[model samples]
Target: MKIYRRGVKLDLSIAVVVMFLLLLHMTGMMYKRELHQLFNEEVNISKRGFRRFRSSEIVDKEDETSKVPSEVAEGPAGTKTDHIPAYNMFHQRITKDAMYEPSAFYIFNLLDELATGEISNVSLFPGGSQIKFKIHFKNGNVAIAKPKRHDRGRYWAYDQSEPFWLDNERHNAEIASFHLDRILNFRRVPPCVGRIVNFRKEILPNTKDEEILSTLYINNGNFCFIGNCVPWFCNDNNPICSEGDFMEMSLCVLVYPSVEHPFQDRPFPWSQGIVESEIWKERNICTEMLVDPEITMGRFFLDLMDLAVFDHLIQNYDRHHFTIVVRFNVESFVVIVDNGKGFGNPWKDDTSFLAPIYQCCRIRNSTYQTLLDLSTDGSKLGNLLRLSLSQDPLAPVITEIFFATLERRLGQVLREIDKCIENYGNGEVLVDKVVVI
Candidate 1:
């Protein structure tokens, strides 16, 4: 009886040990599964790029014990997915009296903050008549700030004196151009704003004198004096000094957002010198190239046409090259940058610059409709431009005469469109929709 009892006890002990081992294995598997699920929730593969799963989606699938909240996942709804429709992301129909978009307003606010924020770094661009400084803000945002040189009469290679009306107010021109581009529903131009900032004294030691004059172009009227001729200048110092030796001279600057992955240096078929040669133009090689199954040239042509129309409206003829953004080096889209050369003269109309649109005879449907509407009633468009530009820190940068000139340019554009319709018919002259992606 004693031996049987000992055997039963040993068997029971073995059974308990086996159960404990099984439980440990199960717990480990559960822990690993939870980790895998969390990782999946944190990263999602989208057509545009890797986007994080929305907090709601993550929380819905996650265990109750998870720490992340649904509210923490909030971001721009348009950016939630990787595959964004080109038209939906880039195009917005604008009316004559259209107000600024909330997104645009938000950007303007951010730009204001960054401009006022503490400067972390400043570096001068290598070459240019109007010196451009790469400024880094404490908020981790980067901007290219071009100081006001119009009053001082600085000219770049592309800028000619005859376009004297441009006034070299490149900074103001930039902001005005951005507003006009927005009005035209072309989301190519980067958000630009006029900012008055004082340069830090620390930057002076690093920047060259020539670079300072070329880029900053501080004048007697704009500079601050220290003790009867000892100039004490810094980015944030007041232009007028009462007692303090330090004085800050305000620089009228145009701040443009910095893009991370620009195909600025990359060469495309259209960028080849031979392609731009007169021989190629005479032969019309560019137009003759049929659309490839892999890459559609129609989208490129459409974007080019849009850009040309925009340049004509502003009288900017210095678009020698354009920047592009690409995904996986396969799909690419144009990014409009360096538009300070626009708005040359309010009195002059450059019909030659509209050649692309006239020759192509294809405009976006929404753009065409907006132009037609504006042609009928331009007061609203003028009002919208005034309102849009008046919000800039430097008010009245764009005058009423400028708005009138814009209307005249718009009328010319309409005439060109009508001519195209007469020649090619509406079906061919107007592209219903053309998206790059």
Candidate 2:
């Protein structure tokens, strides 16, 4: 990958992995660039990189969790086993409009208020576990909901809000995702309002609800979060919605409209009443920038790569679907969202970046086409990113705040990797065992 960066020939890795990735990305790029290429998207993807902006530097595990008291780790958070539901079983037709329709049913099952946390506005839009819900509290606070774990290891809710992945790495990844989010915020990155969970122990399709929603979790750790998970691909009406034939567990976050809908919630007096009243939107994982409107130029081919890399620095695995809603008066404001996957590896370092999943400066078609569709004034893609690292308002959505956040984060990642390479220690089997085990 680095070789490709230096203008060298593509390596074996790029030939294999990048080629496959490009095949899929290009296919969409071609199509998106066609037909609706005139459409102007508003937001943009972070970035994709070799190791992304994560704290996933492999370290001496022996010195890791061991630092924390054994009892604290072994206590309730020690982790128990959790089961995930089958693919495409939760929401067969993941569409944005449909999420609101089935939400009523899921709300009933997910409003119990567990020991650690409680979600509100429970709405069950169909997905991976046949049940999805928006969790809210009477106090007006909310978190997305699914039947997460109970104190005694029981699944408190009745829907599939838990998560699709339940692996140990993923378990830790949850907190790492948040940690990464905070890390990014340290540099002023608004978290990508998204969610991330495990896929382990998921029941196959046709399984009984008792067996499906019945899946449990032993390690709740950071598996739980309070944000959207629909922006990526999960909430987008997929194969059932599109013409493709894809059936799998998808992670996502919703991207709601920026403007308010007074028809739903009337004008408010004091407080962020209106902003808070507006329902936020999100979606699932695309791993790369698809066709986002905020970005319409530069390596128009793969804008997602830039966003992915930006996310890497934040260590935000869940950026796939989250939000950063802001209020500027009765009707003026901006809200950034999406964080399905952030903070790559919780147990790693700020130096380590993944090769295949690394955030890079490649181009994808969706952004390219979307840019082609935008007027020069409305467009803000790669050129904007370059400006972001230096200026502001290359366009509205692409602000200098975002550029600094992204640039500093990238610098942090490079510095870490530089240290790792400089230190050059030989500890692979040890690191792998600690992470994968």
Candidate 3:
């Protein structure tokens, strides 16, 4: 009894201090929630940076209330909380595809409306060899549309080593690539959806280009047109025709109306150039390219690794160039803008597509982990892709064989990463963060 009072007093004081700290933390969190609600009312997230909601997981015409707000709000410390939605929300879906942010879901709905949205203006979008149209929505939004050229069952007839330019830029591939981007939780590809438009009503009247107008003709009661000639097979009088005036196409949103956040295009290191040189494939260009002071210091190399994995999954070897968002002081984000060449061949898994991963022997830790998570026997990536694409108005986007091909390619990617890990330890192969100057 003489000294026991000392220990009891000490225990009491510690308990009181712990309780005070817990109360303070609770108050701080409550205040933050109140402030966030006041500023942004559209989104809701939990304390762990993930939100769980039980809305219609698949998009359809009936769900109008779930549309995502396009405007962004400034968060604490001036960061954009909704500019490009992070994977902060969870869907109640069966697969791990539930990881997409809420805004991503909203974008899908917006893209679906492209099929039926009232058209304001349409004109030829000149740049690449493929024919594309810049479509202006009556509501003031603009999109770049790639008309359907290949059938859903079109198989890859060319050899694996054939030049990528020979492949047709498929509209379904563009839409599928966007969904795959969301599935991989990359959020790099812009929002795209498959749209069926009438050439006579939606495109022909709106298009004033004499070159395009001259190419228009009716064949088998379907509206058809051969786009302006480019270096490839486009000028051979092969027209992209609609199935009786209705053509299925992919519409990609045109982000950044003004050039406030302009994009800077950089040529892919492994490209075969205009002449289709074998020099890039014959030797390991990454050996010399990796040593550059600028490449070694920035996040471009890391982005290339991601691109390699992405391209390999979809069997798209035409990554001749990539675009990065350029702005003051901030790190550049790679945008997988042109993906119409993907899904060209579900039968072939091009090893050259894995060059960036194999040669560099590096990959982002987040990407590696996500791929592993999706490749599990129970949670097959292809099955999840099928689930996600099922939401489109033009359902059955790709053949069932393509789903199996996706899983097969994912296994190949895993093997590549495993090889890199075996050659170099995890410390050397797995990058923790995207280091930017």
| TM-score of every candidate | 0.60, 0.25, 0.74
Candidates 2 and 3, the one with greater lDDT:
3
After TM-score superposition, what is the CA distance of residue 432 in candidate 1 from its true location, in Å?
Answer: 3.1
In the predicted model 1, the residue pairs found to clash are 48-82, 131-215, 150-168, 198-235, 198-236, 199-234, 199-235, 237-248, 238-248
Candidate 3 wrong stretches, greater than 4 Å: 1-105, 160-163, 272-277, 328-330, 434-437
What is candidate 2's lDDT per residue for 102-205, written digit by digit as tens?
A: 22222111111111111223343444322334333332223432332211122212125533133111221222232232222221121112221122221122
Candidate 1 lDDT, 306-423, residue by residue in tens = 7667877877655666555442133344556667777656766758567666655677777788777555542245555664565454556665677778878888988998998999
Q: For candidate 3, which ten residues in a row score worst on lDDT?
A: 1-10
Can you tell me which runs of candidate 1 are displaced by over 4 Å? 1-105, 127-129, 152-169, 200-261, 265-286, 289-298, 328-330, 433-437
Candidate 1: what lDDT? Answer: 0.47
lDDT of each: 0.47, 0.25, 0.64
Tens-digit lDDT track of model 3 for 1-437:
00000111223333333233223222444434543432232322112211111112222322232243332222233334343322111111112122223233334335534544567688878778888988876544568989888789986655655566687888889889987887677767766777677677767777788767887788889877777757464664668788886778788876544344556777778663554337666776777766675455456678778888888888775678866756411255567778888888778767877887887788889899989977875456786677556555566788888989988898999999999899988988898653332
Question: What's the best-to-worst order under TM-score?
Answer: 3, 1, 2
Collision count for each candidate, in order: 9, 137, 0
Q: Tell me which of candidates 1 and 3 scores higher on lDDT.
A: 3
Q: How far in Å is the alpha carbon of 176 misplaced in model 3?
A: 0.7
Off by over 4 Å in 2: 1-132, 146-179, 186-294, 297-306, 313-412, 415-437
